[model samples]
Target: MSIVSSEKNRCIVLVGMPGSGKTTVGRDLAKRLGLRFVDTDHEIEARTGVKIPIIFEIEGEDGFRKRETQTLDDLTRESNMVLATGGGAVIRPENRALLRERAVVVFLSVPPPILWERTRHDRSRPLLQVSDPRGRLEELLKVRGPYYREVAHIIVEGGRGTPHAMVKLIEKELQALCEH
Candidate 1:
């Protein structure tokens, strides 16, 4: 299914867990919608010329979160784009407010087990570099899920559908929003 481009020209921001397919789905959705796509984490890496894990190692999570918030603030200012935000973007109230005010926030919901399965063995994720990555994933989900829901305008079940199908579901939801 295709989404008709409305004149609204809003940014679409995808927020979810680390392995919830935000970058992949956001890229496809942006392509389908004929908009630019920016993954905040990628943008951060590009701007710093260092990978996220390195940033985490050097600056720590608080420092990394500062960068994420700054990147999101910058990206949200652009129009007619799809942005895939870092998993922990919602941790900051300012980031959440900016996202809600400036974009159509989509929460790509995946189960903790699925997230663990998808993210395991990935060394790039600094937060998951633990003796108990599965438990860490579960802990993060429990802590962050409410923040995601609070900021989300649409909640898409990522585990149940293909990326294209998920995009279609998001489009349908956007259409419903427009109707209202």
Candidate 2:
């Protein structure tokens, strides 16, 4: 559980590339912290009544991004929750500001190789549906790393560790952040 120093309850927002274990870690961390867990992608799907791929197929990435921004704005206002954002959520500067100002953002740092290894067989990721996906992952990492860092209050390395272990580490970091 968290020991938030301030009176306001800030949400814990997890930002990272696909397969960086945001959803998994967010769920565990939320459970440990006695908070709700919300994944922006899943919540989008729930609200739209369509899968993200279908949204991407019909309306394209731009439309999906609009939805993502709306969802990010909405979710960031909710207190005492863990939010897992999509890989490209930070593409928009407004979303980055919302996350940074409204919540305590955690960037899950995983290398491109590990990201490829984790997501190679995942067909659901619209961005990685291209030739030379490993290269694409590296390109994305290069492009988005700065944006992630811009909003992150804590950066957790997710290259190694079980979800449970990662949750413990995040919990410790959250506690330490509270102390500071």
Candidate 3:
């Protein structure tokens, strides 16, 4: 059975750790598909009138998560969009439920080593600010990998390519799925 035509109304939800290229790929994917693009982190920041780092600083992870969950709920209510969720968004069961219910989740899989290299200098990620961020990322990946896989209808290995290339790859896969 092919999922191609049935995927027309579906939203594409990108899930991955920080620096996994979710935002970049989502923007490209949306453009390629002529759909709207939304990043949950940006949406949270916009709605709250504060940055994600500030949210983490003020409300902590739990508080930021509440906002993330709400944003995910609102974004999923629409169709034909590419949504890039924050890395921790899948940690909550409700967020997962909303993602599974409203979108075709895709895991932009990145190895822990690559993630460390990409995010090492980035101070914006609250969780990655720890001393042993790589170790923490490894542990987190081990725990969250299953959740990501569970929610994802597809998995795309995010290699060392430009966002446009990644978009093309994703579009190929999506078009293939749609054709059947």
Candidate 4:
């Protein structure tokens, strides 16, 4: 059966490190499932009329996280959508609790090396702007891994396949989950 056929009010949430293909996979999954797509980072930028880096420069990571939590609260209430969250969204216990309760969460697990390769040239990620970005990615992964696992109903390896393939795997897992 189609992933969305089971419930009208359900949402598919994509959580992972930056460059783990959450946004790309989410867009594909949403289109294939005929659902709306929302990226929390983009939503924040849209709402605040500023880029994330600018937000970081002004309100700082703490502030950005506050916006993220608020956005997650609002977006998780919507149905028929695929939501791609920021890498650090799982950093807070409250965010983890809400994600676990509000949607069928998928954690895209990609190794730090691959994530570094994918994100090395991207200047948009506020966290990766440090002098040793690879080290930061690894550290972030180590700290956040448990949180992602805690919040996710499914964990899918992300770096080995195309976004479409990942979506197919996610769809298979979602179908299996629905059956149980």
Per-residue lDDT tens digits of candidate 4, residues 79-118? 8889999999999888998888889999999999899999
Query: Better model by TM-score, 1 or 4?
Result: 4
Cα lDDT computed for each candidate against the true fold = 0.89, 0.90, 0.85, 0.92
Q: Please rank every candidate by TM-score, starting with the best.
A: 4, 2, 1, 3
| lDDT value, candidate 2, whole model | 0.90
TM-score of 3: 0.92
lDDT digits (tens) for residues 1-180 of candidate 1: 222234333689999999999998999999888889999999999999999999999999999999998898888878879999989999999998998888888999999988988899789899889999999999999999999999998999987678899999988897887776
TM-score of decoy 2: 0.96
TM-score of each: 0.94, 0.96, 0.92, 0.96
Error of 1 at 133 (Å): 0.4
Candidate 2 ranges with C-alpha deviation above 4 Å? 1-9
By summed lDDT, which 10 consecutive residues of candidate 2 come out lowest? 1-10
Clashing pairs in 4: none
- Give the lDDT of residue 142 in candidate 4: 95
For model 4, the run of ten residues with the poorest summed lDDT = 1-10
